[model samples]
Target chain A: MLTILLQHTVFGIVTGSILLLATIGFSMIYTTKRFLCISHGELLTIGAYTTYIFHVFLGWNLLYSGVIGVVITSLVGLAIARGLYEPMERHGPLVLLFTSVGVTFCLHGILEFIAGPSIRSFRTPILPSIRVGGIPLITMNEIVIISIAMGSIVFLHVVLTRTRIGKAFRAMASNVDLAMARGIDTARISMFVWIYASAMAAVAGILLALVTSVNPDLGWTQILIILAAAILGGLGSIYGVMIGAILLGVVMDVGVIFFPSGYRAAIAFALMIIVLLVKPKGIFGGE
Target chain B: MFRRTRIVRRVLVVGLSLALLAGLSVGVARAEEVRFGVLTSLSGPLGTEGKPCFETIQWTVEEINKFGGPLGMPIKLFVADTATDVERGITGARKLITMDRVINIIGPSSSIVVAIMKFCADNEVPIISHWSGSTRLTTSGGEYQFRTCPDDYFEGEVAARFMWDEGFRKAAVITLDTEDTISISDALKKRFAAMGGEVVVDEMVVGGQTTYRTAARKVLAKRPDVLFPAIDLDTLKIVYRELYEMGITFTVVLASNAVQQATMDIVGADILEGVYGEKPANALGSPGYAIFEQKYREHMEDGMVGWFTPNMYDAVNLMALAVEVAGEATGKGISENIRKVANSPGIKVYSYAEGLAHLLRGHEINYEGASGSCDFDEFGNVLGYARIQQAKGGQWVDIKFYSSEDLAEAIR
Candidate 1:
């Protein structure tokens, strides 16, 4: 009984940590940009596919593949900004959000065109499990995932709390036009945010690939979990998002021990509906 | 002035001749390669199902080419990945029609088949779906759309009858509300109810749910004789954990055939001790089972064995046969010849190599496959048996086989 509990918890944590990183990307994008990027899911998928191409096809090490994945996806984010967000910057959130939708479709089309729309994963074996103190530990990939999630979150916390650029970002998030008038380089900062979000998405995608299979829509599906987390955390509040992500993961996974198995998918949506009904601003929405 | 004028005339004549020759060559090469559009999810969530099908097409083309090509002319496959999105599926169909100008297409896997079927019918391209089992795709009575896999309505009837025969009078259904799953669930529920069996519980899980606790409780409350699930691996893991720990034993637990090896590993085989489901590829079968087991190990790393692989392999061989029977590589000719090659009366052949040998002998051949017999009804649905596989001692062991004919009679 104890062993099963430990196993489920470990699995939940590993899975949750990967989701946390992906939600961070959504948090950063929503906070700074204040636009609904429905296609943010595909960016993570691009990262996963990039990892597959570099690591599996070309025989690059996993670490190097991750680097390639993040770098390439960051550039894709920049391109999305330039092509979709940049042109619509002066427009309202609705217009900008719609443009992101268009960008998502175009990118999805290109990927389908080139990759031939098939699920692909490394032919290399899954990392073998490790046991410690009579509890079977997860794979090395999962260990790396947890570490990366913690490291990225801590790093983001530091960057946000202790840096001048972070202050400028907060200022922009507070009021974009006001920050622009105050002589902050708003465009450059927004570009940096895009890169940062894209990089976070890549990390999430890579970790997810390590944990499970890398389908063409794997990252996109992960985005749904991210949305649930972000919305639970108050949409733009990074701290709230992280807490929400972990909690959401636990509810879906850990909470299942006492609940009916088929109702698990309903829990997340149900929570969303409840949160909206009770606290429309989310747990950490605008002050 | 005379030299310059003569040079200009010479250059103009040479350029015009080169242009004309290039155009003529383009037209001739186009004639040499007959195009067949293949619609499958090369991307998206359901991409795994389409990957092996893609390989089967490749293998078929390669083997066919070794025998001096289909219809003594090279066959070119124009593939567009649908990404498993319905809108993208429609776009893929358009691309195949307008860009490839193909006569027939192979897939888009599931309900996406319905969308592509509409387009293929409109464009007059005969389509033989390799994996999608939605009855609506065939029952719509469309002229151009044909499937190589059994419909869920038929498969569901077989499943319900299996439970009935196994002496389980009370059943519980846990299903996802997706178009495909819902279709199978609804059919199963109606059939089970009509079979004088009590459907003690009916629970619908939202698509893509990873947990199954609340729904599991609902199913447990019914105290069903059997629990039938329409779900995938992720949800199955949660279901197994809750069911076993809660001490819910049953006469049998049954589900749709999508549980991969990974799910078993996650929850242990003890929990799935009596679970049963339907599958197309049973290692117990002949011809390609050995080869499939070997190649599946090599190519599909994901540890999930989908029922679609054998049908995928058979679809390719059928296409190769159509090409031979048509004596031409055009779409119209191939479509006209599909039934001849698939359902013909003769000594049967299995592999592409054997198929080629028979083609050489100018002999009509039936292709018996690893999945089952490759007999197609008028609707192009594969006529075969659904084998019942039970999870015993950590493997999906086959306990019984239900033929379509037998199932049809039982359902009636």
Candidate 2:
């Protein structure tokens, strides 16, 4: 029982970290943009597929492709914001909302067209498992995930709290008109936010690929977990999103040790619903 | 804004015209060309399976065309990617049947087979599934749906029987959460329990889940004598690796068809050593398999390794045979003729080339394919024998054969 509990916790934390990466970006985008970026999953797919292409196909170093994939996908996000989202910004938020969905469908089709519809596995490096006192520790990929997730949270915290542009970004998120009145360039802040959120999503996608195999639709599936986490963390609160992500991950994985594995996904969705009923604002929302 | 509106109008007009042109072409195009739709997850996680099916079908179509088509008419292969989406499966099937006007459809491999089977049966379109092995496909009332691969029930029963023969009593089942998997696991559990074999634990894993430690720990806690994990290749490899790392060992680990050569390749030999299960016979085991394997390896750049590739190759050939035997590519005629060509006795059709020759020489060709014999029962299912193999010395060594009859008895 002790071993099982510990194992479950360890595994849960690894999953939580990946979920945190996805949700943090999702939460940030939602907070500033004020609408669901349905194409966020495609951003993840871009990151994963980019990593697969760069690292696996071109035989580039894993670490190099990991960084490059994140960078490329961040650029993709910026492009989408400027080219697709910006056009509809003057129309209405709803127009941008529907356009995001259209972008998602189009991206999905384009990926299918290029990748030739086959599963591609990355030539994953064999990292040794850390063991202590006879208990095997998780893989280095998982440890990297936990570290990156923590790093992201801390970095975001510093950026939001200390930086001038970060304050302007926050002001814009709270009220675009008010921020513009205060001489903050709302458009610039929106672009920065889009780049930042997408960069985070790319990092998350790369980390997910590191831990698991990369596929075109990987981002679409991971987005569900991210959505659950972000919703549980009150949608827009970065700190809350992180905590909610960990909690959602734990509940879905660790909470259902005895249950059949199929129920794991169902549990994640069920937790979101249950939390929504009890604490609609989420655990960290009151802050 | 005016320019944008102009572009939108042009797109609408062009889209409408294309639709109209396609509709008109459908009426004018003669029914001489044998049209078959290959529906599989060509663009999603399961696209690996779909890719080979497409390639095999295309390759078969090319060969048939070179020989002057199925019945002196060129074969037209219409391919669609379902991406493993259930809804997309239906849409692809409908398009293949209604728009493409294909007499037969060959896939979106696996569960998509069962999904499209009902629709095909209703519409009277003969669907020869290349990979999916759902019980629903062969259970009953699926006259139009034909499967070339061994059924899932056969897989489970074969796995269970192998364990039973090995004298394993207590078993734990770890299967995927999907309905297709759960049903097969349930069937295995019921069968194992009926044999007085104790199923100490039954666990499920969601598809696309990366980590398996929690479930592995829980399953290990049960301490069953044997672990019967029925899942896809990707998930199975992850679980096996986790179990190895955790230092967990059972007297036996029984896997289904998913734990074949490709899976064994991923996790390496050390983890899979001594793991026993029922899967399609290795391509090395049969002369027909060797010939196809050699040709595929030589000619194709992106060909799939192991079982399903040849199975799909045979399925495409079987479709052509069905068409030839029926004397026309009508759904009703083709579906009925499948059994006639598949189970024809004393007929020696080793490959598509051979099958084409036999067709020309006025002989019924029994497709003893690379995957297995394409012998369909009254249920339109071929009960192919599952090969029992153990991972040893970095390779799968076939120990013996577990016939479908043995499975039917042992599972019950």
Candidate 3:
């Protein structure tokens, strides 16, 4: 019984790490823009498909393909911000939110048109499992996913807290008008946020596609959970989002002990609602 | 000036009458061609299944037209994409019914058929489904709906009998939360329990989830003698992978839905070796089926056909035969004569041309379609048979055949 409990907990951590990667970018964008970016999920799809094209179709190495995919996804993210979001920014949050939904559909349609909706598997050889004491069996793919996710989170923490640009970003996130008045180029900062968050989303997408099969709906299907994690983590606090994601992930997996597996999503949403009802500003949101 | 004006007015009147006559004649000529609506999910998640079915329908239409069509007129197809969603399916059905004015419809899924059942019944349009296996679809009293595939109830019963025959007592079932999977799983559990077998674990998982370790763990905790996974290919892959990773070994008796070549290719044969399942059988040694396989390969870019591809071909041919026998291209005529043209008490015909020729000669003909001998019961569901298969040497090999009566008796 104890081993089983430990196994679920480990699995929950892995799930939490992936959700954290997804939520980091999501929350960052929301921090500055103050609007939900529904199209952020498509960045993950773009990343996975782009890497697939490079590795499978063009015969590039996995590492190179992933790097190129992330770079391209970041560029695409910036382009979207400049082309669509920038012009519609002054029209209120609802307009931006609706536009994001439209963009999400457009990206989903384009990916489907290109990939034809068939499940695509990576050509990477399946690694043998490595069993640890008192835990579920883990694979090399899971290890890599966990390491990269943790590494990216730590790096993001450093960048956000220790650098000059990070300080500028924090100021903008806190008060855009004041930050712009203090000569902090809010436009460039916003563009940076889009690129950085998109890059992280791409990494998350690649990791997810490696663990599961890649399809057009790979990102869309998980977007709701990503939203729940972001909302539960208080939307703007990166550290809070990470904690929220981990908590949600553990709950989702551990809840299966009592409820059926189909209720994982419901359990997570229910937790989000309970938090909203009691706390209102999330666990880490400022009053 | 009065004479000139009178001459102009006469010319205009004459041209107007000539145009009206020409329009009426064109309308009559257009009505001579029979239009059949083909609705399937040509895009989205079910696109892989939908595309082949759509292509098969097209191929059947082409072949029928080559043989001078039914009733001495060419057949035309108005195809639409459903995207595997009910709302999109409704839109496609409406377009096909109102805009294209098709005489009959062929769909690739039971869910879509059920969704459009009321509309088809109201409009008196007959819809022949190629691969929908839901029991409720036919049992809903939609007179215009007919299924070429066996219902899930039959599939579930067959699965239970197969398990019992294999000497498996305790069974655990993991099914997707979809209506079809749920029904099949429920049927299996009920029948298996009724037959004095134990059901240790019965769990439902939502589709499109990336992880199934939690579900797999819960299922494994039961430690049943056998596992029955009645889920889609993608979810099945995840669940099976998780089970394998957990160092769990048990016999897996899959539902017919997951027993496909595409599924095997995606899930890897190594994981599926020796797994048992059942599928709707094709007329294996029939000359008509051989021709279909050849033509399907020639037209399909992937050169791979699913089990239901032949059913789509059979559906199109059956509709055409019914139309010919009814002697009209209307939904009421097609629905009224579909069972007559497909059932027994007539000369057995294999191909569309053979059946059409027999029907034209004023003789009753029964169509043994490429998919098999299709005979629909009163509920618009076919009394079908399935073949038990196992994955051996990285390929599916048929081991036994179970007729509907055989399965029913086993359950009893």
Candidate 4:
């Protein structure tokens, strides 16, 4: 019984790591842009497919292909911000949100057209998993996922606290008009945020594809849970989103012990609803 | 008064010409063709199977027209995309019956078929589904409904009996919580219990989730002698990978729903070796299958075919044969003659042309087509054989064939 509990918790953390990576980007984009970016999840799909094209089809090294995929996804996010969002900036938040929904469908359609709406996987050689202290059995892939996610979180914390550009980002995130008045270029900062967040989403996508299988609707399927994480964590705070993702992930995995496995997503949503009922502005939201 | 009389004469001439043209066109349309509705999912997740099924139907119709069609009239196929959605399927069925005036319908998924069963029954249009395997579909008293594939109820019984024969006493099931999966798993569980076997764990996984680690842990804890997975390809891949990573080993008896070339490819041959599965036998040894393979390769992209390809081929040929046997181009006539042309006490014919020739000679014909002997019981369900297959050396190898009687004995 204890071993089962340990196994479930370890697996939950692995799932939580992916959720953390995804929610960070989702929360970052929503906070800076001030509209729900429904197409943000498409960045993950783009990253995954792009990596598959390079590594599997074009015969590139897996790590190099992943890097290139992340770069391409980041560029796509920057393009969306400049080409679509910037042009429609004056149309108010609801219109911008609806436009993102349209962009989501458009990106989804393009993927379906290219990938033929079937599941695909990276053609990697299989490796045996390692047992840690002969207790909880985990795979090398799981270790890699957790390591990268943690590394990114730490790197993001240092950058946001220590760097000049990071300070400017924080300023804009807090008060865009004030930051602009203080001579920080709001447009440049927003573009950088889009690129960075999308890059994070790309990493999440690649890791997820490695863990499971890749399909055109991979990101679309998980967008709801990512949204739940972001909203549960006050929608904009990086650290808050991290905590929220871990909580939701653990709850989802552990909840299956008490309930049937199908209730995983329901438990997450129920937790979110309870949080909202108790604290309407979210657990960490100010005012 | 003179100008008014001239205008009235011009109007009268134009009106008479318009009415005469409409009547002539209607008369020509009625004489030239018989239309049939081909309803199938052409765009969604099922499209992979649905497209090829539709193409087989289309190709068969073309072949029929080349041989002077079923009843000396050119057959016109009116296809409507169901999109694999229930509401769209209902709408498509309605439009086919009401607008296109089709005599019969062919090929939609089980859920869509069930959703539109009453609609077809009300219109008295015969719907022959080639892919749907739900038992409730044929048993629901929709006399107009028929299916070419064996139902899941039989598959479930076979699975339970196979497990018992293999000496697996404690069984665990992990299935997707959909109607089809649930029904099949329920049948298996009930039958397994009836055979005095214990089901240790039954886990229902939701669709579209990234991880099944929790579910995997639960199943592992049960430590059953065998695992039966009735999940989709994607989820199955994840669950198996997780199980392997956790160093858990058990015999996996996959449900027929998970037995596909795509599933094998995605899950990797190394992981899936020795896994047991079952599918409706395609009767690959039959001469009709050889002909189908040769002709199907010429038109299909990638030169690839699925297990259900033969079923689709048989569906089209059966409908055409019934049309020929009925000697008329109406739904009721085809309905009356379908069983007569499919069952025994008749000359055996394989293809549409052979059946047509036999019918033209005033002889009864039984079709043993690419899928197998096309036989339907009283409930519009086929008593088909199931092929027990195992993953061996990166390919599925057929081990044994179990007929309906054999399955019945096992269940008994």
List candidate 4 segments past 4 Å from native.
A125-129, B1-34, B41-51, B73-103, B287-294, B297-305, B325-333, B408-412
lDDT of 1 by residue, A129-247 (tens): 57667444466666777888899889988888899888888888888889999999988888878999889888888776655556555665666677888898888788888877776
Q: Is the docking of candidate 4 incorrect, acceptable, medium or high quality?
A: acceptable
Q: Estimate each model's TM-score.
A: 0.68, 0.86, 0.92, 0.91
lDDT, residue B165, candidate 4: 86
Candidate 1 lDDT, B142-194, residue by residue in tens: 35666667777776787787888889999988886556667777777878888
Ranking by DockQ: 3, 4, 2, 1
Candidate 2 vs candidate 3: the TM-score winner is 3
Q: Give per-residue CA lDDT, model 2, range B348-405, as digits (tens).
A: 6777678778777888777777777777877777766677778887667778786555
DockQ for candidate 2, C-alpha atoms: 0.35
* C-alpha local distance difference test of each model: 0.71, 0.75, 0.83, 0.82
Residue B337, model 1, lDDT: 76
B1-412, model 4: which lDDT tens digit per residue?
9999999999999999999999899768956777788998775546656777888888888988988888888789998888666788899999999988898889887788888887887787888987787766646642577788877877788788889989999999998876567767887898899999999998888877777877787777789999989776767878888787776667988887678777766888988889999677766677877778877898677586666778888888887778777777778877888988888989988888888888888888888877767787777888666877899988888887877677766433
Task: For residues A98-120, write the lDDT of model 2, one tens digit per residue.
Answer: 99889988998888788764455
The TM-score leader among the candidates is 3
In model 1 chain A, which range of ten residues has the least summed lDDT? A119-128
What's the CA RMSD of model 3 in angstroms?
A: 3.8
Question: Candidate 2, which CAPRI tier?
Answer: acceptable
Model 1, runs deviating above 4 Å: A1-287, B1-24, B42-46, B137-143, B209-214, B233-257, B260-274, B281-306, B344-371, B392-394, B404-408
